[model samples]
Target: MRLFGYARVSTSQQSLDIQIRALREAGVKTNRIFTDKASGSSVDREGLELLRMKVEEGDVILVKKLDRLGRDTADMIQLIKEFDAQGIAVRFIDDGISTDGEMGKMVVTILSAVAEAERRRIFERTNEGRYEAKLNGVKFGRKRSIDRHNVLSLHQAGIGATEIARKLKIARSTVYKILEEMKVT
Candidate 1:
């Protein structure tokens, strides 16, 4: 039987030693270990893809945590379902549950629900912030600093756009844009 281990860290600086050791201690072969440093926020991971390609029926896929699989529940569930479709079992080291067992499926389901809840909460909070900003008369975009007075004054003084931009320490295109905004030729 072939067992493949998958390990992920949010950044390359973080160590994958813990997961590697845990998987090896769990009886996975050293040559079968696949480790990477990538964000768990999404499923578009290179390491995950490599594991998917190599995994076959009855293969065991190991990880450290549920979140190491994904940041959202749907993504986590999708990952599990992919393993399910391939008949590959997911063994979480920390949780000590293997998808090949009934208890493991229950744990994965619970964790997936929690992840979905967190994502929904974040979405609501973001919407509330935007709404509050609008109600408080606070602009929710980049502030406009076209310098209307300077542009109009310089243009009225018969200054060329290029020279005006140099004087203002801005770009020539910025001068032209200002002129356009001011309805000046």
Candidate 2:
């Protein structure tokens, strides 16, 4: 049976060194390891897709941790079930869980659920903090690239949207959007 390894990080700035080292120490060859610098919530990861295509029946997939495999509980459960049906086993080294037996499957499910719950909690807390900040008059989102007042003055001075956009180095759509907002206000 072929052995494959997968590693992931939520952001591009995060390092995969530890996971790679762990996978290598587990006897997974360097060439057989797939890594993605992406969020676990995203299923469109190129590395993960390639790994899925490469694995065959009787092949085993190894991950450093269960949460590293996926953050969504349903997705994680579905993946494990799919692998199990295809005669493939998934081993999570840090969690010490394997999808090789009923007990291991059960534990993985529970842990996945807990991880998903924690993710939801973090989401809720972040939204709460954002709401509180908004209430306190803190602004969010990207700063305005062009000055609204300048756009209005330029429009009042008979400057066309295209001319304003060209002068400001912004899109014509942005010039029109600013003029529209000024009309409403």
Candidate 3:
């Protein structure tokens, strides 16, 4: 049976070196390793799709961790079921879990639920923190580079949006947005 490795990271700034090294050490060939720099919540990963297409029956898929496969419990369980149906085995080296038998299946399910719960908790905490910040008068999003009053005055002075943008050292789109908001254009 062929051994294929999968690795993923949520962002471009995160390194894949540790997972790649572990896969290599586990006997997964360098060329057999597929990776993606994407969030585990996303299932539309190009690398993962390619790996799924390339794997055959009896082939084994190795992942560094269960969470590396996915954060959504249903999606992760569905993927494992698909692999199982195809006579393929998924092994998570870090978690010491595999879909090889009944016990393995149960363990995987429980762990998947826990992972999904943790993800939800993180999301709720983030939203709570943002709500608190907003209540404290903390402004979100990018700071305005140009004032709406200035743009309106310039527009009233017969300056076109393109000229106003150039004069104000801002994009024409920004000038247009300001004008649109004030209904001056």
Cα TM-score per model: 0.67, 0.59, 0.59
lDDT of 1 by residue, 90-114 (tens): 9788977677767767866776687
lDDT of 2 by residue, 1-185 (tens): 98899999999999999999999999999999999998888677899889989999989999999888887776777688778878889999998888877786686678668767877998999999999999999999898777899989888888888998999999999988888888832
Q: Can you give the lDDT of residue 184 in candidate 1?
A: 79
lDDT of each: 0.82, 0.88, 0.89
Of the two candidates 1 and 3, the one with more favorable lDDT, higher being better, is: 3
Instruction: Candidate 2: list runs displaced more than 4 Å.
Output: 108-185
How many times do residue backbones clash in model 2? Answer: 0
Candidate 3 lDDT by residue in tens digits, 145-180: 678898899999998989999999999999888888
For model 1, the stretches where C-alpha displacement exceeds 4 angstroms are 140-185
Better of 1 and 2 by lDDT: 2
lDDT of 1 at 89: 87
Worst 10 residues of 3 by lDDT: 107-116
Question: Rank by TM-score, descending?
Answer: 1, 3, 2
